[model samples]
Target: MSNRVLKILVPIISIILGLFVGAIVMWMSGYDAINGYIALWHGIFGSSYSIGETIRQISPYILAGLAVAFAFRTGLFNIGVEGQLIVGWFAAAYVGMAFELPAFIHLPLALLAAAAAGALWGLIPGILKATLRVHEVIVTIMMNYIALHTVNALITTVSDGSYKIDRIQKTASLRSEFLSNLTDFSTLHYGILIALLMVVVMWFILEKTRTGYELKAVGFNDHASQYAGMNVNKNIVLSMVISGAFAGLGGAMEALGTFGNISKMGGFTGIGFDGIAVALLGANTPLGVIFGATLFGSLKYGANNMPNAAGVPVEIVSIVIALIIFFVASGYIIRVLLNRMNKKKEAK
Candidate 1:
């Protein structure tokens, strides 16, 4: 089969395999797998409120997936997206609370603060990799802890004594005023629109811009890029900065649109970590990320209903997601088996 066909078939097959495995797990645990699945579907697609919640969940995933996907394209493993997200959340929240500007200025300013904070967080590992010849993975991992503790301390000591940031200014919050009728007061906001716009922007930058070419070239081969007069170091740093910006924006969207505040003790939310899965599942493409985010969002929203309806554990959803990722990543084994079966048939 052609690579393109394989690409299309692999994820579909993996999803089927994952569902089968999940069913087996449910059966072993004394639950009716079919009922569990039905509950999941009902939660995700049954009502307008469910659908809106799914979309809200997907908004952050879209941006976080883009962050990881963009870094992957540059051959960088950005494990620090979690840290960047925390920094962005705090920055946006702080800015939102500190300012008293009009809605237009406050909202943009908060978002910009988030992007800047995330970019700065990303820059640390980028600089370490560029100047000190350190591996980005190592630096980013360390930075995650730094970000977590720093944010925790800031929230605990700097502002309100609580573990959460103050509620954002009304003007800074992103509301679904226009879509209120459709969403039924779900916290689904304009962040979804922003995420979609960023996807288009990312696609355009990666496919049609010179900087994108340079970043990809460096990722493919730093030595070759250097020989070809590409600034490999600069590209590496720039790629991380851009990746962090995406993640930061994701944090901003979540803080202002959904949470309306930043948590202190929780530090980096798992959204950044989940982004890695989303990026891999999407094959690191803009369109792929959107689909991956949608699937994840649906599963997450659906899982909430399973516990109430079918006596199934919500954690099963994570297991199913893990199974899907595992199967997809190991698709070559499936391909080899299929090829061998085909060869035997031809010989017969």
Candidate 2:
């Protein structure tokens, strides 16, 4: 089979296996697997409200997936997207609350602030990895803690000891009354449009730009790229910065679109971590990430209905997602099986 076909087949096969195994688990636990899945489907698509909220959930996942995928394509492991996202959230929220500019200026400025904050957060690890040869994973992991505590402190300072920040100005908001009404007053917003735009942006950058070529070349082999006159260290820094900017935009989607404010968190949001799975399932491609994010968003959002509708535990859905990720991670085995099957067909 062709590489393109294999790329498509692998994720589909993994998802099927995940569902199959999930059904088995449900059956063993004395629950009707089919009914659970029916409930799941209904939860995701039953009402316009469900569809709107699912799309809303998917908006951030798309950007987060792109953040991880961009870094993966550039040979960087950016565990700091969570941290970058936090800082971006804080920056956007602060700008939205503190400034009183016109909609055009205020909104753009808030978005820019978010991207810049994330880029800055990513820059530290990028610089360390490029110049000092420190591992990006290590630096980014530390950065997450720093970003969390620092942002929490900053939020308290800005809010006068309150854990919550003020809502953004309406002009700077991404909320859409038209979309909300269209979707039965769901918290749907224009962030999905922004997310789609970023998808195109990521694709254009990686597939049609000189900087992308350099980044990919550096990712493939820094020594070879250096020999070919590419600036390896510079590309590394640039890749991380771009990846971080995507993650920051994800945070802005939440602050400006979904919640309209920022609040203290007891723990990580897990969006960045989930982005890792999304990237893996997507094969590190821009368009593929959309489908991956959609699948994840559907499963996650729909899981809420399993208990009420079918008496199935929500944890079962988590297990299914985990199994799907596991199977995706084992793609080499799937490839080997496919190759063997192809050989058998050829022989026949």
Candidate 3:
């Protein structure tokens, strides 16, 4: 198969394999696979409210996926999108509460604070990787723990007893009454626009810009990039910074659109972790990430309803998502098949 065709076919096949595996598992577990899927569908598509909720959930996933994919394209494994997101969430919330500016200024300021915090968090590891060749995976994993604990402590100390911060001022919010009313008061907001805009921006940067070319070249072969006069270290840092900024915007969406307060994170937000799978399944494309996020979002929204409506364990939904990731990761198997086809054609 051609590369373009393979790119499209791989994700589709992965999705099919995931659904098939999920059905087999359900049948083995004595669950009604048909009913389970029916329930899942109903949960995701039955009501306009449910549809809106899925979109709201997907908004952050898209941004988070962009963060992981952007880093991947630059040959960087940013396992710390979680950490950057945590810091950005806290920073956005803090700015929202600390300031009393007009709506136009306050909202932008709060969101910018989130981006700045994420970029700074990413910059630490970038600098380390550039200067001392420290391993990013280890550093980012450690940073996740640091961000979690620090945010919890800060919130606890600042709250004077509560584990959550005060509700953000209206001026800093991304809430949209029109969107909410359209979906029977779902948490849908203008942040969805921001997410879609980022998709376009990421595509433009990766596909139509010189800087993106340099980053991709570095990712393909750092030594080659160096030989071609690309600044390897600089590109690495730039990639991480941009990736973190994407994650930061995700945090801003959660803080300003969905939830209006910062709370103690007893654990990591799964959004960043899920983003890794999203990025892989998306094949590191901006448009692909949006589609991947939408799929995951449907599963997430439908998971809760599966148990009550179909008597299937919610774990089944998780299994389906995991299977999708597994298939995506094993995409080299598809390439082998394509290679065989090419060889046969050449022989003929």
Candidate 4:
């Protein structure tokens, strides 16, 4: 198979294989795979409410996926999306609840605050990597803990020793009566538009701009780019900042659109980490991320219904997702098979 066709084929086959493996696991575990999947499907898409919830879940995944993909494109591993996201969430929430202005002003300001906070968090690792030859993986991972603890402290302080911050002001909310009514009063919000728009923007910048060329070149070979007059270190720093901004935007969506408050967490909010799988499954492209996010969101939303309706464990759904990720990450196997087929056809 050609590379183009192989790209499409691998993911489709991986998804099928993942589901097949999930079913096998379910059978071994004494669960009804068919019933589980049926319930899962209904839970994710059977009703207007479910559809809206799926959409809402997907909005953040899109941005988070973009974050990872952008970093990967620039030859960087951004393991600290969680940290940047947390800071962004707090920053957006801070702006949202602290300000009282028209929606047009407050909403954008809050979102920008999130992006800025995320960018700053990301920049720290970038500067370290660029200047001191420090590995971003370590810095970013450490930063994640720092961000979590710092945000928790700040939120608690703001809430006067409470675990959660207050609800955002009305003017800063992304929720809309029209959207709620359209989706049968689901928690979906206008943040979906922003997410979709970001996808478009990512595509445009990465595929149609000189800056993208520079970034990609640096990713391909930083030394070569540097030799060719590109600012390799600058590109590295810029890529991380951009990636962090994407993650922060996702946090802002969750804060303003979905939750409407910042709550204490005992552990990392797994959304940013999930973006790694999303980027891998998406082939690190904007359009591909949309498809990957849909699958992920469906599985996530559907998993909640499995135990209740199918008499199956919710962990089964996670197993299926993990299987899918495993297969996608093992795509070299698929390509080898495709190459063998191509050789056979040539021999014929």
Candidate RMSDs in order? 1.7, 0.9, 1.6, 1.0
The candidate with the higher TM-score, 1 or 3, is 3
lDDT tens string, model 3, 48-77? Answer: 889888899998899899999999988999
What does candidate 1's lDDT look like per residue over 165-263, in tens digits? 688999999876766568776778889999999999899989999999999999999999999999999999999999999999998988889888877
Model 2 bad stretches (over 4 Å): none
For residues 1-348, could you state the per-residue lDDT of candidate 2 as single tens digits? 999999999999999999999999999999999999999999899999999999999998898899999999999988888988888888888898889999999999999999999999999999999999999999999999999999999989999999899999998899999999999999999999999999999999999999998999999999999999999999999999999999999899988999999999888888888888998999999999999999998999999999999999999999999999999999999999999999999999
Ranking by TM-score: 2, 4, 3, 1
What TM-score goes with each of the models?
0.95, 0.98, 0.96, 0.98
In model 4, what are the clashing residue pairs, if there are any?
none
The 10 consecutive residues of candidate 3 with the worst lDDT sum are 334-343
TM-score of 3: 0.96
lDDT of 4 by residue, 1-348 (tens): 667788888899999999999999999999999999999999998889899999999988988899999999989999999899899999999999998999889999999999999999999999999999899999999999999999999989999999999999999999988878888999999998998898998888888999999999999999999999999889999999999999999899989999998998798988899999998888999988999988998899978888999998989999999999999989999889879988999999
Model 1 CA lDDT for position 191? 90
Q: Sort by lDDT, best first: what order? A: 2, 4, 3, 1
Q: How accurate is candidate 4 locally (lDDT)?
A: 0.92
Better of 2 and 3 by TM-score: 2
